[model samples]
Target: MMFLRYLAAVPLIVLSCAGVPFGYLTLSSYLFQRSLPGEPAEFDFVAGFVGNVTALAGFWPVPVAFLLFAGLWWRTAAWPRISLLPSVPTAFVGLVTGTGWAIALGVALPLVSWGLARLAARIVSRPISGDVRRSAVEVLIGLRGGGRLRVQSRRLLLDRLPPPRYRESPVGRVAIPFDRIGHVEAGVVDAPAQWRFGNTSELTITPGPALRVIGSGQEWLVPVDDVDAALRLVVERAQARAKPEPRPPLESARWASAKKLWDLGEAQLSQTGQRKVRHGGHHVLLVLSVLTVAMTGYSVFRVFTDGWGFLFGALFFGAISYGTGRAWVSAGATQKLAEENPCSPLADDPDPRHRPITGWSYQPVVLGQTSDL
Candidate 1:
């Protein structure tokens, strides 16, 4: 199920694919059509390689996107025993996978890795049951940055910083966790200048420093104030891991009815998963899709100089890529959804502390043992 969840993250794959154009441009600008710094005879191999790497580092939209995707999988899936799997190797793997699989490799790699990680976990890693501390929080900010996060429940940083308000407005300053972000447009809650934190805003994320505010068993992408708030909110969420809140009889009846529907859906989903694993029709389709995306980057290279019609190439690429996403969801997702069915004792709980690995789910990590994981 955990594998299925990661497999479903094709959007992240597409985001990384955007690097295709950037890589093209960077290479063209730096190496291929470079303005040589000195006479050709003076060009040193070591200097050239280092400079190229630096230029590549400067254009990091693709790598950062892939890093997020890889980190999520590595921390939640591999971890501990697979300690060395993610950091350097994950980066290299992401780069390899992002090479215009635009459709093919993106889907295939997730499916393959998901299975491997699970199998490895069963062998090398022991489930730290009821343990929330080891959740994929590392995926959020600890990408390459190392330090254990000590969960301090109920700790707030409102006092550590200036009162969390700007003038009369509720200043919602999102410390986005990207290194080189551009063109930010944030909305104010009450009015302009009267901003609020945590509002959903479009982010143009690049590598350096991203302010990923994860907490309360939500996806790793939520914007929070500080780690203190993260600890407080996350711990508050999982602090109830040992017990559950009693729902009213009416709610329970409604939940029971929902459970019946969920069970039926689960059976159908399991069948579908089985069909995918058995028939494998999508494998061929995936190959075609990858070829299509590679063509997309090539077909309309001169978007800036070419007429507006070139934009259609990008649109076509997007539509085709979007269509290919369903094939990416692994069969394990069926089991994941089934496990989270109402029949499960922890189905309604958001505490990640209870799960060993983050089960099949979308991007991000919550602090603590969550049932939904």
Candidate 2:
């Protein structure tokens, strides 16, 4: 199993590092020339542009793809019958440049996967969104009660969690239909007291109101943002859906759904911050780009001078410096951000309910070194 994991990871690592523009460039060039026989000049220009872009975008998907693949594998590696097939498509998508067919395949495959999963769920259990089979419901977060609670519409989907808990489940969902909904309430809860030095300390919870759905002997407390517009839309949509006669959708209701309103509120809150700090990591990228260009120039020089030894030395040394610089810059930026906003999701916290209550999960700390076994 360990051998298989290492084997699976090796190819993805190699592809992310070297396959990006080069392999795709070659494949795309051949494809374009064959497909567009009449447009030879256009094809040449397109192929050359893609190749150059990929070359410039060094280590194409490595930084992002490496972490994603490793994280997924770590979780399921212990399972005897683990399947890494679901991650294959995404891994492939990350190998290519973020353009042309790559973009289409990357984006389309994930959407199709999600759609198919939803379709299967509907087939197995009763469809949550009655007549509107494909209901426009967005899940803000998972509810402890069972499945996730839909943001606006009076709908709830069953849990997709693995067996045991699923087997013991009696009911798939509990939803208060539009007309059945008695009243909706939104309010804020103060952070629970924290113990420090054997004494309680009062700490203000992160910004945002919580939602409470009350009707049909069920009251579910959802710990997501409770924007006024979202709460108002819930009432309005319920009224609309409950109406006896059919009518065209209202203008506000058509474009701005409950999810949109929640997103707008989130944006507003983020922008509400008065303190401004210089953003991080762009300068690191600028340095990387400059070094890459310098390396490219040297490669050209070495080709003319036939300086193989110097070329190899520069390549190895430059890679080490680049890796060191990347690691430093990433750490520095994260530290700066955490220092600036201690309560931000990126910071460390001693609070146990940090994630469940506030949706602020603690970021994992990466030590500078680990002792050898």
Candidate 3:
């Protein structure tokens, strides 16, 4: 039945056939019309070869066909893993697919990498049982950079930063080990200044820094609801794994070294006049969007001298930049929705302790964890 459905869609998929000629023509015009005088023979040969290849490979229709077929497969396939199997064929599909397909694939390639990485993580991640920190569901892990604090349960799992071995896989992130965790701190702190947007009149809940873990003198921010509870869980988990065995001289020395760095960081942070400005992901996107608008203005100016090509290009590119900024802002807002008033346990200490958490008093709360990759 699925095969018959795919067969029926073959003709519509072939509508992408128009992309081949369109891509070739666009590239030929761009390459031939551009005035490149006094260039070396090697450079010309390379440039011509690249142009031909790009036109043949990058044609936008290929991705449209792929996306269409992907939707078809998604509806019929029982397992998500099966859907990813098609990625191997994508390279072959793009080769004959044309310039439009190639360009579309290039754009989607990052999302593809990210998707595969997440999928790989799901496949390899083990289930949580007892004190062994397996894949966790309730724990919302956030890295230094701002992103949605994805809920997971594993004691150690790949996050934004994948392990060295899965470097190309894009999904296997190495999480901070609970065994090394020394401190879990939370408090009502001043929210980042940029978060002050859209709340000019009403006093919004002061967004505090999320639960922080101090380990080996470094701090990791964990964005989770009931941050105090999460802190207790981490502390409890760490304590459960703690051994009374004495530390080796070398190990103690490394701890001492890490302590010095931690103290140095604290001293720098305490100094009011010499503060470094922090920029979140949203801020970066907003800045880039503004810059893109300025660049678009230049392109618009070029349109008067060049043609409709520059005009259309500038509009399309400009919209993409603006759209990215808007999208990031929306995502940030959704993440903020999870924020709650700092619970009593967390509110007790805004400043994270340098010492390792041991013998936590609070009972563990079994909050549900998300399996979203």
**Could you arrange the candidates by lDDT from highest to lowest?**
3, 2, 1
Higher TM-score: candidate 1 or 3? 3
User: Which number leads on TM-score?
Assistant: 3
- Candidate 3 Cα outliers beyond 4 Å, as residue runs: 1-98, 102-110, 119-140, 143-177, 180-209, 212-223, 226-229, 232-373
Q: What TM-score against the true fold does each predicted structure earn?
A: 0.26, 0.27, 0.29
Give, for candidate 3, the lowest lDDT window spanning 10 residues. 195-204
Give me the displacement of residue 212 in model 2, in angstroms.
1.2
Model 1: how far residue 20 lies from native, Å: 20
lDDT of each: 0.33, 0.37, 0.38
List the RMSD of every prediction in angstroms: 21.0, 21.2, 19.9
TM-score, candidate number 3: 0.29
Runs with alpha carbons beyond 4 Å of true place in candidate 1:
1-48, 51-237, 240-301, 308-312, 326-335, 342-373
Candidate 2 wrongly placed segments (more than 4 Å): 1-148, 151-167, 170-173, 192-208, 243-373
Q: List, residue by residue over 186-258, the lDDT tens digit for candidate 1.
A: 1111111111122111122222222233222221222222433343334433444223223334334334422
| Candidate 1, position 204, lDDT | 21
